[model samples]
Target: MIIERKQYKLLEKIIFEKLVIQAPFKIPNPMPDEACFLYMLEGQINYKTENQNVSVPQNESVLLKCGNYFSQIKNDKSATLHQIIIVHFHPKILKSIYSSDLPEIFKKPSFIDDKIDLSHINNDFLIQKYIENLMFYFDNPTLVNDDILILKFKEIILLLCQTKNASTIQQILSQLFSPTSFTFKEIIENNLYSNFSLVEFANLANLSLSSFKREFKKNYSDTPANYIRNKKLEKSTELLALSEERITDIAFDCGFKNLANFSHLFNAKYNCSPSLYRLNLKDK
Candidate 1:
């Protein structure tokens, strides 16, 4: 439950926001084209990305890149009420802020790193002081003006550059200016065996579910379900024939949910149980 919410805008863009809420808070964003710096002033939160989930503790903060995100309150029995402040960085805002002089930090790096989209920032002395100073304006909302807000925004960027995670933050911020896109086939081949649903795959591809299905059909000439299942089964058979691992492990590695389902599907496709199939391969 949201007890209270306050926000300050820059040219009608939400530049900063504060929220006070009760437990059971959940936010599922399909995609975000801007970066955010979030501070947990009162309680913990679990922010999940495609690759990992992070537990953000009270008084700490995190810097997240532009990507899909799911966030929920990390419950503490004694504390049901939580407070948080988020500072947003939109491409247009960055461009407006640095129109006269672009910072070295925003320049493209010589080498790019892996596509890990989350960076946890521990609220050290400098950052903690910055947060405290900003809260004063939040307390006396009238004291805040556009110039002050812009200065504060610039202040945080400099502070982030000073932090040990500056390189990672640089990479994240760079993406805001120069966004990257993945090829459709590259997206499919990379995530085909993982546990992501079709909708999630569509979100990753930046396409609607219907369009994703259409593209899948156009490129592969088969439904996503049929193609992925057959591919998984093919890998499972190779594992069964070559490896001495447990069938359950092989099933999971190849992306089936459970042994019974794997056996049933294998039987349906091959007309033979996995156990018998393995035995026949061993005998041969």
Candidate 2:
């Protein structure tokens, strides 16, 4: 399935919101700037990350860091997912909380260069409580003060850190000061061509091809080639929707080798060829 990139209007102030989205059968590429916490409320969600592909069954929660390349493949049947997505204004968000005299856990950076393990925290009751608090904040977004909300967000992090299976706070903290060595963002931005290979991608991530493939499957539930194709197809669809470009031009721009291949993949993904898909949208 192809992963579509959804564009959102940026919010000037701190925002807290809950999202309920039915899994649109196709997989979606990662949003570059947003940091998300996804809780599986009633069904299954398959997520592929740079290093792993994991499925969050009902009642499980997952944390996704910013700039991590990922895609989601949902089950065929309807599955309910409640997500708390917070887009921080970079250093400002961290600076506000770091200056406070909160616990050491809160002082640590919330955004890290590497992915931290929150999977070991097995207390379902506590997880549910956090999810509830998240929903409450979403319900009363206006009443929620940025400072207090930030603190509560800190508390949530600290609580998750306290979970038995969570990595030691120190280990997680080390990531803040560590050098930002990996360049998944560069890979996505520079190599939009269909010819890019998995071996090359693995080399860029500094992992063996086997290990990279394994982790990629674990995080995204799709192989590297499939993920890239999905992203390209997503871009093609967006262009088709908003631009006056010709079909052959769109195909080339999206890195497809030819018009026929683009139509084949687009039809397979959206259940309609590119021309018909655009026509249906125009009708609407």
The top-ranked prediction according to TM-score is 1
Q: Write model 2 residue lDDT over 138-224, tens digit each, in one string.
A: 666575665656666676667666666444443343333332344554654545543346776676567799987887787678887
Give per-residue CA lDDT, model 1, range 123-156, as digits (tens). 6789889889988989999899999999999998
Ten-residue segment with the worst summed lDDT in candidate 1?
23-32
Please give the CA lDDT of all the candidate structures. 0.80, 0.56
Q: Give the Cα-based TM-score of candidate 1 against the true structure.
A: 0.63
Candidate 1 residues lying further than 4 Å off, grouped into runs, are 28-31, 76-79, 181-284
User: How many residue pairs clash in model 2?
Assistant: 13
In model 2, the runs with Cα more than 4 Å from the true position are 1-15, 25-35, 78-91, 100-123, 168-185, 189-284
The number of the candidate with the highest lDDT is: 1
State candidate 2's TM-score: 0.51
Question: After aligning candidate 2 to the native by TM-score, how far in Å is the CA of 268 from where it should be?
Answer: 13
Residue-level lDDT for 245 in candidate 1 = 72
